[model samples]
Target: MSSEAEGRFHIVDVSSLTSVHRRMPRRVTLRTDDGVRIEAVYEPSRASVTDTAVVLAHGFTGSVDRPAVRRAARAFAERGASVVTFSFRGHGGSGGLSTVGDREVLDLSAAVRWARELGHARVATVGFSMGGSVVLRHAALEAGTVDAVAAVSAPARWYYRGTAPMRRLHWVVTRPGGRLVGRYGLRTRIDRRAWDPVPLSPVEAVPLIAPVPLLIVHGDRDAYFPLDHPRSLAAAGGDAAELWLEPGMGHAENAADAELLARLGDWLVGG
Candidate 1:
């Protein structure tokens, strides 16, 4: 064989590649209270019905097609659980505008209802970045409905005491120049107002989720939310919650790390 062909054959790890795609197609459109249709992809359980379901929420300016979102869906589905991933209003193929975490909470509630209607007795949520805050807040407000929650790199206090980097990012995105250009062509005026980085303040809501298992994961080197936020959240939850402070990982590592995936899977499995 040619040297290039030999190298390619050696580098390919066939064992890691699936011979066929095992994922099934799932399309759901949830109608919000305001008459907006929210787009979501549901991945049903590959194993028997465990009365458990997993919901994946994307970060700000993100869509359900994000790499992390897809990996999470596949990860949970492979574990014999159902997975649902959706785009926030004004994000991806969803309708309406982003209202930061304030209005997005309603969208999340709608998702939870959808999961319940699908016959999932126990529902857990996993969110990344801003989506993390949404899940945290939802779990707090709707404690009776959500069985558990895992938030990766979520900001605990956004309105105040947020990390400096995130504060700066908020400024940049909401600034006149940033708003005027409108990166996504989302109606600059509406987009600019929606991009405001107001904190969702999950700290206040932490106690509400007590007794309900919570998993907080944050990268020590996270530039967006910083480690303090997760620490605060875990501390607020006391012994009821688990905090995984990855030494070298940065934000959104849970979507890629096998160890992190295992931890999350175990939590969802009632370990």
Candidate 2:
């Protein structure tokens, strides 16, 4: 594999790394109906009444502090839109175990409601990988709740494309040598069947989000999720959705591309 491809697959410590100026994010807590409280970082827009707020959701096994998520939040904030980044349940500072994307959708729903209460008239959700699935599912479940949506490297057909690799990775990380951290919790504590992404697949949810401007961004070289997933979603949405295939870009490439940022910003501004 090429060096860039290698970097794309390797996971890094996003929370420890600092952005350009080493700025600290403003933090807050969002409480769910089930009484689960999640940690989130909020960055308000610089411009007056942008009419749109972007809620950033990280991927499975990812936290709000993940570098890509933080970068996206910062970029949206700089562009005059309120940005809220939060950890899904069992990910970072949040409580409870991860239910893959099923229960996480509730957490996202709560966050979106919180944003609405904060004077945001139109809400846009941006999610990466597993996070993408959550937002897409939310849009479908709660139609008319979100104004716009964007997802990067999100899986559409989960059973076939999603589980094989993640299951192996889970075993590797939760096994003896990597068991020092206790990140995924006991195997008995997690429902292996529930972790399947098929139940939360976005392929079935795309048609449900019709007429609600959707933007599906995926890299042509994405190793995790193939390009066809996003393309399928865009096709499902017909003219209602926009799909962008970043040339030579792999999964979660938005963190490093200005052009991707521009495309997202333009979509947000209804440009």
Candidate 3:
């Protein structure tokens, strides 16, 4: 990184980003309410912007610095919506271990605050996969923090070990040895503790998020939670929410194409 480029990065704490790719967004460090350090990037909107800030939540083991996350930010930025992307605790350059979907609401809430601090009057969130679940919970629990929320490829209910991918995921979070694989191989840290009382499931969280607009997006071919999860979320959300069942879309941020993001961006800034 050039000296001039280095000036753009904002160091919020002693922790810093280890690397930066070509044309990285403006970086800022954040601390979650639970004292977890979070790494986030801010991408300003292009011409014809609608003055709405869109905060993106990545899936399990994903960070704001990843290529796919950056690409998705660009997609939204190109649509004239300022975007914020962040890694949940235990992921990327952030501190702490993953609580999976639980406790991630603090991280999303922190990012949303950062977006508002950047001067955007309206805010929206679009989360993918595990991230998809986080946004729903955040909107429900926080309330009035965001104008709209979208959950893509999110499971409506929790503890769903039905799918092969989910079963494997359960193993990663539930087993001691699997945590090693997550830490060493995937660069993700898993929390060993289980959900004691269990948090509100996405389906249950959906109704509470209204009259905050909600959007549920899913792929017919998703390998994770399947179509029924999205259907359940849509059903729970009722008329205040919109559902999009993409034919070819697969799962999460990696599966999301530019066109789908553009449409989502439009919907977010519409209200």
Judging by TM-score against the true structure, name the best candidate: 3
Error of 3 at 119 (Å): 1.0
How would you order the candidates by lDDT, starting with the best? 3, 1, 2
Off by over 4 Å in 1: 1-24, 160-168, 180-182, 185-200, 253-255
- Candidate 3 C-alpha lDDT tens digits along 95-186: 77788989889989988987776667899999999999999999999989999999999999888898899999888888988889998989
User: What Cα-based lDDT does every candidate model obtain?
Assistant: 0.70, 0.69, 0.83
C-alpha-based local distance difference test score of model 2 = 0.69
Best by lDDT: 3
Better of 1 and 3 by lDDT: 3
The predicted structure with the larger lDDT, 2 or 3, is 3
Least accurate 10 contiguous residues by lDDT in model 2: 1-10
Report RMSD (Å) for each prediction in the order shown: 11.4, 9.3, 6.2
Clashes of each: 2, 0, 0
The lDDT, on a scale of 0 to 1, for candidate 3 is 0.83
Q: Which is the better candidate, 1 or 3, if ranked by TM-score?
A: 3
lDDT by residue (1-271, candidate 2, tens digit) is 0001011112222333333211233566666656556776667775544767788888766777767777777677767677878887766766665666777788898778767766667789988887888888999989999999998888876644354565564653445543333354422122233343346469888888888888898888777777678888888878888888888887763433766775686677562
* lDDT agreement of model 1 with the native: 0.70
TM-score of 2: 0.79
